[model samples]
Target: MTDLDTPAAAPPRAGALRHAAPALLGYAGVRALGLITLALWSAANGKSAHTLLTARWDSLWYTRVAAFGYGWEVRLPNGDVHSNLAFFPLLPWLERLVAALSPLSYADAGLLVGTLASPAAAWGIFAVADHVYGRRAGVCAALVWAVLPVGIVQSMAYSESLFTALAAWSLYAVLAGRWLTAGLLASLAGLTRPVGAAVVAALWVAAITSFVRERSTPPARGAFGWRRALGMLLAPLGAAGYVLWVGHRTGRGPLGYLDVQGQWGNGFDGGYAFARFVGDKFTSFPSALAGVGLTVGVALVIWLYVSCVRQGQPLPLLVYSGIVTALALCASGYFGSKPRLLLPAFPLLLPLALALARLRTSRSAAILGAVAAASAVYGAFWLNGSGPP
Candidate 1:
């Protein structure tokens, strides 16, 4: 069916929120456990969980943007320059707005935005899985996402949840054949992060495929419409608009954004740098276990993509997850941050979620509970240890 195929959405089984409640509640419970564990662990170490969530790592960069605006940079003794320009503006912009409207500090505002966006992201993930498999699979998918080793990032003042929320809803809109809604949300997603391109790519691929289908299939119900064409036009504007603005501001033309990223040691090198980093981990006996772990993680990610393809997921999902995976894994730097980067690639969990859905309720719940506790403990330890970049 074409993008105009509104009837592509299944007949109303239940009101969206009413149906998504299980996923949402399960997600909330998992997140709560994580936060509680973090709180207790941090307290025992004389640290504040709130500080970790709102003031550390990239959260500092985001709050800096909200408080002082951009054009900030950190020049290190090693000749590395970290520029705030490397960060997309939408999250910081929202933080600024939230701070202006409330008594909360910029950091707190950022945490608030992420806290709200986490549930939205979960709901959107539930929507997608439910549409593709069934209600039970959807619940499992959302819970699966919650139990991710880096799932604690979803609750921090980070852009991952915000971007995922926008991306997931945009994808849902695409699957529902609401072309305009899809494009609009995709545009917003693009505004949120560099990975937003994955959503734009998904929309473009789906729209182009629809065009190809229309060329062969006779015009009738669900045929390509002007809305699809307009959606195709709208999908890239957010990213392009921001990049072009940076270009003009930097006087470097269209590639100025790339220069900004480079200033922060970020660029696309097709995983070469990442491979080297992982390989180096094996140079010392003390680090070889981590090296092997990294290799296994990469292999697992790749196998999941293959499973998605073999499972015959819709083109939009396959394209979206593929690009998200490639970008997250292939990035030249931020080797330790790759897992956090994959937060938006929720579709990768569908295969496992579908399998989990087949288990008896008690068995699945027990397994999920154990996994969730482990994830929560690991999240606490992670933040207390090296932590995410």
Candidate 2:
């Protein structure tokens, strides 16, 4: 790699805190706005925001897993069975840990974990962007992620926040050449979400490229060798271990976890199912408009990724974002939740964030503030109505 391509070294803890303060504060403000809006909307609608965030939908399943260790299933009227094993174990494990140490219930403990982790995720995002671009871009990137329509999930009793925190830090570690740290974080991410494989893949690609580069260059005495190999070995263990354990428990052998996910109508079909879903959306006028919007959104995401490649973004970020986008767009379940699933693809926002950073401060603030308000309102309405599934 050229000197320009080398990853920026991380600032010390105190320096990092100082540098990232604005971004963290901005992200926290956006989340606080979303929560306040949700609280007001819930009160007006005779509902509880706490219950909405902590006791509903996937949150309930996570809490159940935390309180009782898996082995739960729900049989739908359509004769489909949904197994709790479809959910990864990290978030629940954290919830259980928090609940054990505190007076909180499993659900509340989950809320607490998500609440704390969201800002940490933002910080990791800022560190990565700052390393790639600069502090202003980093701050913008964090704020952009914060104002996403589905950003409220970051503050709920969900695994997205936790997983994003791990993924972001893992990517940062990879960029900084901290192989072991990257691998450990990637493994934890795998334990958190299936998409964690994106992280593992990025690390693997980076390790391979480093090995090739070292072989071509005049090797220094102490160089990239055992550490990189060890990281590659550690990277897949978390996801593989969980999947194998689930298989063993369910008596389905190696494919047991796939069977569990299949019960939920989720599997990798190389985007065929998603293509059909979009086509079905065009059956009516209103639905056709929705389909058009979906198509445009997907196109925009692809264009942004291409922009990153054209700009020669680091290989790790490119690989990580590409895998994340592919998985989110191609998932076969919960059509309405694809946007939420795309939350971890934060690098996709970096190009836009850089543009925003180049704008005048007043202009950028106005744009971000307007979007944050709209996102907060949308999040409130979404939760009060049919939120992410």
Candidate 2 displacement at residue 316 in angstroms: 0.8
Per-residue lDDT of candidate 2, residues 1-389 (tens digit): 22211344656989889999999999989999999999999999999999989987899999999988899999999999999999999999999999999999999999999999999999999988988898999999999999998998998999999999999999888888778888999999999999999999999998888777676666561264676787889999999999999999999998999999999999888788988989999999999998999899889989999999987888999999999999888888888888989999999999999999999999999999999999999998998997658
TM-scores, one per candidate? 0.96, 0.96
Which lDDT values do the candidates have, in the order given?
A: 0.90, 0.90
Instruction: Summarize candidate 1's per-residue lDDT along 269-336 as a digit string, tens digits.
Output: 99999999999999999899999999999999999999999999989999999999999999887789
Candidate 2 regions exceeding 4 Å error are 1-9, 221-224
> Which pairs clash inside model 2?
none
